[model samples]
Target chain A: MQKIEAVIQPSKLDAVKDALLEVGIEGMTILEARGHGRQKGHTEFYRGREYTVDLLPKIKLEMVVPDELVEKAVQAIVSSARTGKIGDGKIFLSKIDEAIRIRNDERGASAL
Target chain B: MQKIEAVIQPSKLDAVKDALLEVGIEGMTILEARGHGRQKGHTEFYRGREYTVDLLPKIKLEMVVPDELVEKAVQAIVSSARTGKIGDGKIFLSKIDEAIRIRNDERGASAL
Candidate 1:
């Protein structure tokens, strides 16, 4: 199985979640995160001493699916999370080695 | 330190939270994630065909700190999240280029 992770704008969370659901993707994980890309961090003045903020607020979404569905899932997220802006965020794909259900003690794919 | 993320069992979340709090790591974000790895998912009986599920439920945690605090933070997570089990999940560390606070428009490290 593959894991699809996206760091996006908080306001875009609902739309992305809905888009995934529309594609028959039921389960997903979302978290509030902070990061920066080409836009870098922004400048701020606090008590007159200019301070730099390197971490920007972002929403992290994680989902797992069979290997065959990886590409489709990525596209689903890209289209759903896109805002045509610079701080739109990024998506990552990774390999999962195993999975288990803590509640029922189920293992492998069945645990999903 | 850095961005310390862990994909761990749901049952272990509270314990981890308490541990981090003990160390003065106050702010964090958590999400419900799913994945399958070495265990490869499991078999289940649905109607007649034994369908296999590959995704497993997990909690994703993200945090940011100064580069100097990386090791201490990683240790905090390792000790807090350890259960001596096979499906304990994984942790990843990466470099972040910048950060910004949308509310006040702060940038760089101060955003953390």
Candidate 2:
């Protein structure tokens, strides 16, 4: 099985989720994160004062799918999350040795 | 080397951290999350109205560990996070091929 992790702009989360669902991908874990990347932080005004915020808010989506679905899932994310902007974010693919559903001891891809 | 991702109850965060530290695993990333599993969500009253909230708050801890320490690290987390209850959470292990520390371009396991 393979795990697809995509770090994306917060604003694009709903679209990405919908896109994945359209492709028949349902189960996923989402996390809130702060990302530091090529795009340097910018100054923003809050309460009439400017502050330099270095780490930008980001959303990370993680899912484990059967090997066959990896490519489709990645494409779904790319199409939905892209905004022609620098921080559109990144997708990472990795191999999962085993997956066990804590509830019923379901193992392997079925557990996913 | 393997990357250990643990989705655990928010209340167990501190104990899990201390357990990992005791086992010599230091660096880790923590994120806020919501989880849905066998332990179904319950209804809660808000503003004098009852609402069925399905997803529950969770904490996700992620770290890449050297191959030799995967077992030990998993043990630490299991021991610390387990509450003998329904939603104690789960751990996932995956293979990482090229971890790069964005700051200095460090690669491989060293970047972890």
Candidate 3:
């Protein structure tokens, strides 16, 4: 399975969540984070607020899906999370060696 | 070194934390999250409330540990976080190409 971690604007969270759910991706985790990208140390825009600092508040959505669902998931995130703005955030993809459902000890895809 | 991301029940946070600290593994990023497991859309148990929505509260513990501490850290988390019930979460391990601490530009393990 592949792990998809997308750091996106907090304002776009609702839209992105709905989009992911619509794509048949039911399981996901959300996190509140602060960071900067290429536009580091510049004024950052978020939820109608502006901050002239190196780091800006970001919402991170994380999930693990079967290999085949990676592209669909990424597209869903990009389309919903995008604002055509620099602080729209980035999506990271990585390999998950194993995933175990803590409750039942199920592993791999089923676990995801 | 490996980046360990564990999404577990919020109630287990304290125990998991102490376990890692006891093992000399400190410095972890904690995020408030909402997610669902195999059951997908259903009732969720969080901090003392009923979540009848599609998602449930989860605590995501993330940290990068030196290769030598990976096993010890994982064990500490697993032992403390498992509840033997459905809401218990999963652990993901991934390769981290590089880690840079911005303050002094410390790289690799130092960054972690």
Candidate 4:
């Protein structure tokens, strides 16, 4: 299985979620994260004071899928999460050794 | 400076939250992360599709702590997140070069 993680603009979450759900991928985890890319955060004005804000708010989505579906999932996320703007975020794919469902104690590809 | 991440049972979240709050660590990001172990993702029936789902639902908690408090945080998480069950999840500690808070631009220890 592959663990697909995407760090994206928080605002893009709903669209991404809908896209995934439409693909019959109903399960995913979302987190409010702070990170940066080549832009390395940015400057913002608050109360007339310019501050070098370095940690941009991001939403991270993690999904575990069979090796065959990895590309489909990644493409769904990339297309949904894209904003044609800076801080669109990035996606990462990692290998997973196993997966299990705690509710019923199921394991292997079945537990997912 | 430890990024303590716990892949745990979703039900354990409330208990873990109380524990962390008790320790004065209120900031954290929770992601629904799917993973497996020696147990792996298991099988289930959804309308008898009997199709294999390779992703198991897991909760992932990430926190940035001071070097001095790494042990304390880890211990708190380990104790709070433990279920003594097979899919209780795991914890990982990784080095972070820098962190920033976009709202205020606080960096490093302060941002965490």
Instruction: Please report the candidate that would top TM-score against the real structure.
Output: 3
lDDT to native, each model: 0.66, 0.77, 0.83, 0.67
Query: lDDT tens string, model 1, B62-106?
Result: 887667766566667677777666556666555556777789998
- How would you encode candidate 3's per-residue C-alpha lDDT over B1-112 as one tens digit per residue? 7888899888899999999999988889998887755565567766678885556888889999898998788788888988786677888877888998888999988777
lDDT of 1 by residue, A7-47 (tens): 88777777877677666575565566666556445553334
- How would you order the candidates by DockQ, starting with the best? 3, 2, 4, 1
The CA lDDT at A47 in model 2 is: 43
Each prediction's TM-score versus the true structure: 0.49, 0.65, 0.78, 0.53
lDDT of 4 by residue, A2-99 (tens): 67888987677778877776665655656667774564446633346543546666678776667787888888888998868666779998765545
Q: Which residue pairs clash within candidate 2?
A: none
Question: Higher lDDT: candidate 3 or 4?
Answer: 3
Chain B global fold similarity (TM-score) for predicted model 1 against the true chain B: 0.80
lDDT of 1 at A7: 88
Question: Residue B12 of model 3: what lDDT?
Answer: 90
DockQ value for model 1: 0.07
RMSD to the hidden true structure, all candidates:
12.3, 5.6, 3.6, 10.3
Worst 10 residues of 1 chain A by lDDT: A97-106
For candidate 4, what is the DockQ-based docking class?
Answer: incorrect
